[model samples]
Target: MYTIHFETLGCKLNQIETESIARFCADAGFGVTMAHSTASQAETAPVLSIVNTCTVTAKAEQKARRIIRMLLAKFPFSAVLVTGCYAQVEKAQIEQIDSRIVVVPGTAKDTLADFPQFFMDLLTKAGAPKTAEEAAALAKDLRAWQPLRQIPAEQTENRLKPNSKDTKAIESINKFRLATDSFMHHSRGSIKIQDGCSNRCAYCRICIARGESVSLAPAEVLKRVRDIESGGQTEVVLTGVNLTLYRGTLQTESGERKMDFADLLEYLLENTDTISFRISSLYPERVDDALCRIIAHKRVRPHFHLSVQSGSNAILKAMHRPYTAETVVAAVENLRKAKDNPFIACDIIAGFPGETDKDFEQTQELCRKCRFTYIHAFPFSPRPGTEAYTMKNQIPQRIAGERVKWLSDFACKSKTEYAKSFEGKTLKAVVEKRETNIGKAVTENFLHIYIEENKQTLKDLAGKEVSVLIKQALDISGKDEETEATAVLVCDGA
Candidate 1:
């Protein structure tokens, strides 16, 4: 029986992927050491390791390599496996220096009832399962004994995947029930409602890798939420390749559509008091009046992550992003009309193919005009197999990197200025993470507030939504703004 350590880097999607990977390993009969259950939760040991990485930027790639080195140093004789977008596109470079690390581009596609068997197969190309007594005995023992171990206060499933037995990992989680996470780690968990994307935005390889979009039905989604509720989750987040694309019905042959995202939201609001739901990122073009109205529901978190790839109209057309900048502005305005000053997050890519000084200025102007609190600024990275990969006059790497820095810094400044408006004002918030009374929570306005230190009681606030005033903006590095007062909790978001 081999033990494994799971590490994931970047994005909510990456977090979901790591969970799926762990589930796969647990199901395959290999015992998942209860050590690092969540991506942020880490323990130093467990020689066998897997790094689910990200390569959205050069920095992310460097961090992936750093983690790989750190893991190798910790587990000298351990089998190491690397997977995710970074490995998928940069396989040659990844293997060149860390040949000792087994690289699998699309790990989710590979079935290893457990991580150990995958490792065993890495040792030998066959991922064949074991009905053999030695392996069976170990699997059986691990299963029987797992429940007795002191799992952390917050593990969704105390007993993880039943000994692999060649079953698909995460299928169970995706099926009847989801693991319950204890602690205040997102009481409303993100459920991957769909996987993969079809639109290949020139500078992205995600579409090519994840393939066409496929969505999970509402029934299945409801079942999973019910499971999470049974396990102690209070809310469920509807996440997807593109959340707006959940197209499924009760009966396929009848050609009758059961429900779309809007319908799903109405159903969840009506049927389950045990659940509060939030939809993940949505494309600006995907938002219709129906969807926007559903988002206006009081129960839904007033947060919309609109993808505004570029502000330049020419750049948008060249990048093949569906929405125009004007359309994006209109969507933002429409949401504001529905849910006043709702926390709108957006993605901005700088230095795309054919991007000129005028185009960059357009992006800057959009940033100034758009009222987004959370701005994810990224410089375009040309990925392999993408149309922009071969496109000439590619934004110089250094220039792209500079753009990323400038945009990100500017975003932080803008976000801080936006957040400053809420200082001392009462706003509903949910306690997300905590260390005593000193913890972090998100106001419905979608502001991240750090609970003031020294004098507070966090005892009643765990997973509870309380009223908070926007105190002061903590700089990206955690330094506090002088004019800002401390965050004080007043009571729930809904």
Candidate 2:
């Protein structure tokens, strides 16, 4: 059987897409193998490899290029196909890097299901037949075939300049569909309920790459949730580019009902039983009373990741963020009041254009007041085509780095304090990792707990909710710390 290897980089949404592509390949009569598997390491490597890349930042784009180069070196003869944000935004740059690599933009990602047939057509033109023996032998000695050279000029031209039919096919994808039967991660499932973004944050390139926002219908989302629940998935995370912007209309028994993010959550909580749901992220202004009330449901995990790009109102205004510092604080306060010990996290850009020392101090003050569970802090890297890139008074790289370090230190302290607060408290956790004498689980509030238990018991507990008592919270906040010392509840009778 012909084998294919796959690799994914970036967010949970990208992971979901990669798994879907793998399933599509399998349905196309290709056996799947890990990119670094022993089979792939053999003298005859897998004939095909797919890399789903990320371009969230310049660093992310660099990583994608590095991975592509590494894969090329490993599988010299195999066909390499690259897709995702980086490929979408910088198609010419990626194509120039390697002539053999097939570049598919984000708009053409859904068309990945058609890639296997595309590959076969190329092979047939190169004198390879569809018979089992010939296919196997072709895979073994694929280096001699030079698939890239074999590709017809017309086919290459079509890929470079897709006609209106391809455009229409891409535009028609309104609902999120899973091409894979199983998720890459067994402990929890992720469903992309929405895609793209409408927000034009000054420093963001994601909106440019993802295009306008599009939400999946509530009925389709519920159907996917039910299917995941039936598959024994105890938890499902609803992911999207801008989750708060999700809007759709669903036909119910009552009649046609328009559903926003909150309504969708209520519908899922009311209809689904056996599966808990968690949202990927939200905007502070979108966290209305209705959404808070729905989130109070036990099935909705007590974790809220807000896109609070800056705690300083001045900086926020410069970044074109929709909410103010006061708005963000109020949102967190309301969420805390609605749910007990809910994990509140935020995305913070340390330094932006025209940010003064006073602005940085305001951010620190806000961080101290809010007591966030964690903060994803980074020095703002201006991207091409973004307003911030050309804005005046850009902070020096050294100053930005210093600001990031200060914010990171504050975040570590807040996280440590928050985790310590749960010491001796029993929380519901889902097992994610198992070992001979230890295991790791994540609580609904987004705490990572390490439990001391037998491997078999922990393995069996995987994908199931169990009560875990937080015995101790070790201070593992150092930069190089690999595992936090979180002692959890022991199994009864173990």
Candidate 3:
């Protein structure tokens, strides 16, 4: 059997997409293996290797290129296919790195459901390989073949032109079809409810790479949830480029009704009984009262992550983020009022063009006032096509690095304080993994809990939600300081 090795990088959304592609490949009769799996262990080289890349930061893109080079070196005979934001934005550059590499842009990546057939057709065109020996010979020849340069006529046309009116209708119908297989084997599964983003943040290349926002149909979402449940997944994470922008129209027996993100949550809560849900990051301004009320539900995890780039209104305006510092404060207040002690996380950009020391101080003040449980501090990295790249008053790299260190240190301290507040309290947690003497779980408010228990006890609790008393919050941040601090959870009867 032909095997395909897959490597994925970037956000949870990228993970979701990679899972779908894996499922598609499996359905097409390819044996799927993790990228780290050795070819010697598999006893044969994979026919194809896929890398789903990310380009959120310069470091991320560098990592992707490094992985591509490593994969090429290890799997010399395998056809390397690259897709994702990096491929979408830097196709020419990636192609130059390895002319044999097949770079598929994000816009056409979804059409990878048709990739298996495409590959088979390519092999057939190169002399119709009918026997096993012929197939192996064809595969060897593919090492030198330039598939990307000689894409089929129909496939090339489809990528170039817009879909016809009839094709759009058919695509809309197909969008609601659910995949029979689960995306991930873990208890927590993520379904991408929305794709793309409309927000034109001055420093972001994601909008240009992902295109406009489009919400998945509610019916398809519910169907996928049921499918996941059937596949033994207990928790689900609804992810999107901009999750709050999810909008779909529902048709009931009575009449047609519109459903926003809030409506979708309520619908899922009212419909699905066994599964719990966690929402991905949302914009601060979109966290409305209605959405907050729905989030207060017991089945919904009380973790709210906001894309609050900076605390200073001046910096926010420069970044082109719509919300103000006041708006962020109000949003946090609203969530806190709706649910007690909800875990609030914020993304902060330390250095931006035209940002001053006073502006950074404003950010610190806002973080202090908001009392965020976790903070993702990133130093600004200018992308080539973004407006911020050309803007004046850019902070020096050394100064930006210092600011990031300061913000990150504060974030760790704040997280420790937040974890300390839950000490000695009983919280419900879902066991993520079970080991011989310890089990890892996460609480509703997104606290990582490590339980001390025997192998069988931990196994029994795996993939199930159970109550645990928080004994002590540990600072497990020694070598991997970037990792979160985990709390020690004592099993009630163990």
Candidate 4:
């Protein structure tokens, strides 16, 4: 089987989409591998490589470009397919990188499911291009084939129509069921229930790249959840660009009902048994009482991450965020009230245009008031076409870095304290890493705990939600990377 390697950069939504495409390829009889160190690999190089790009930060896009360049240089014979937010915004720049590259923007990511067939057809057509000239010609042809652009109506319609071959292909792809099934990349299953963001924040280009908000239908989401449960994946994360903005329709016994994110969660809880759900992230303004009530469900994991950009209303208003600092505090309060000691986290941009010293201090004060267990602090990087890009009084890079460091340190302290709270308590955890002697699992409240494997093979516990007794917490904070908030634990009854 031809090997296809995937590298994903960005959020859980991007990872879900990549896994979906990987499953499709695997179903099409292609060897799917997720790897980051392709340049150092000693095994046979893959015939094709797909890098799912992220445009969240300038650093993310830089890394994508670097990875793509490395992939092209190391595996000359492999053709590269780049897709996702970064590709959507900088298609021309990425396309100019190499002739072997094919750019598919984030908007057409759903079309990625049909890529395996495209790759198969390309291989069949090439039939072993032995010479450099033959390979170059093949690459040119591959680059010319824009999968999402300007397809003939008849061909598109015929492809969409139900047929024996089409049915078989769909079955094969869906056979994988859960996005993480037999996949080496992720331990927990992921379902992309929503995509694209409608909120046009001043500092964000994701809205431009992803376009308007769109959500998966409620029935389809429930079906995906059922599939994950049947596959023995006890923990599944519901991912999206803006999860709080999710809106869909569900056919109820009485009639068709419009459902929001909270309703969707409640529906899944009512329909499925034993499967725990995790919400990727939320907007502070949208965290209503209904959402908090649904979050109180036992099956729903007590971990929530919010996209709270800044704690200062001044900076927030400048960024065009709908919620105020007080809104975040209320949301956190509601969440805590709903679930005891829920692992509340938020994203914080330390420096934005026109942010005064008082504004920065307000952000720090908010973090202290909210007592977030985790804080994703980013030094604001101006992006082209963003309102903040041209906004005056841009914070200096040095000052921004310092603010980020302060938040990072605070986050480390908060996370370690939170982990300490769980010490000696037995909690349900989904196994994430299973080696020969040691296994790692994440608790419902998002603590990463490592346990010794005795009498049972660690591999057998992979993807299983097993009981673990937390022994102690460890602070593994770093400068470049966020602290993992890991702890050492013992398996229950071990």
Winner by TM-score: 4
lDDT, candidate 2, 191-287, per-residue tens: 8888877777778766656666889889888888898888877788999988989998998689999999999989888898878898899999988
Tell me model 4's lDDT, rounded to 2 decimals: 0.77
Cα error, residue 284 of model 3, in Å, equals: 0.7
Better candidate by lDDT, 3 or 4: 4
The C-alpha TM-scores of every prediction are 0.77, 0.85, 0.84, 0.89
Best model per lDDT: 4
User: What's the residue-level lDDT of 465 in candidate 4?
Assistant: 72
Residue 440 Cα positional deviation in candidate 1, in Å, after optimal superposition: 1.8
lDDT of 1 by residue, 10-104 (tens): 66766665665566666655555423333344554453577877766667889888888776655555545677667655655765654346555
Q: Which 10 consecutive positions of candidate 2 have the poorest summed lDDT?
A: 160-169
Please give the TM-score that candidate 3 achieves against the real structure: 0.84
- What value of lDDT does candidate 1 attain over all alpha carbons? 0.62
The residue pairs in collision within model 2 are none
Identify the runs in model 4 with alpha carbons over 4 angstroms from their true place. Answer: 128-135, 149-184, 433-438, 454-456, 479-494
| lDDT of each candidate versus the true structure | 0.62, 0.73, 0.74, 0.77
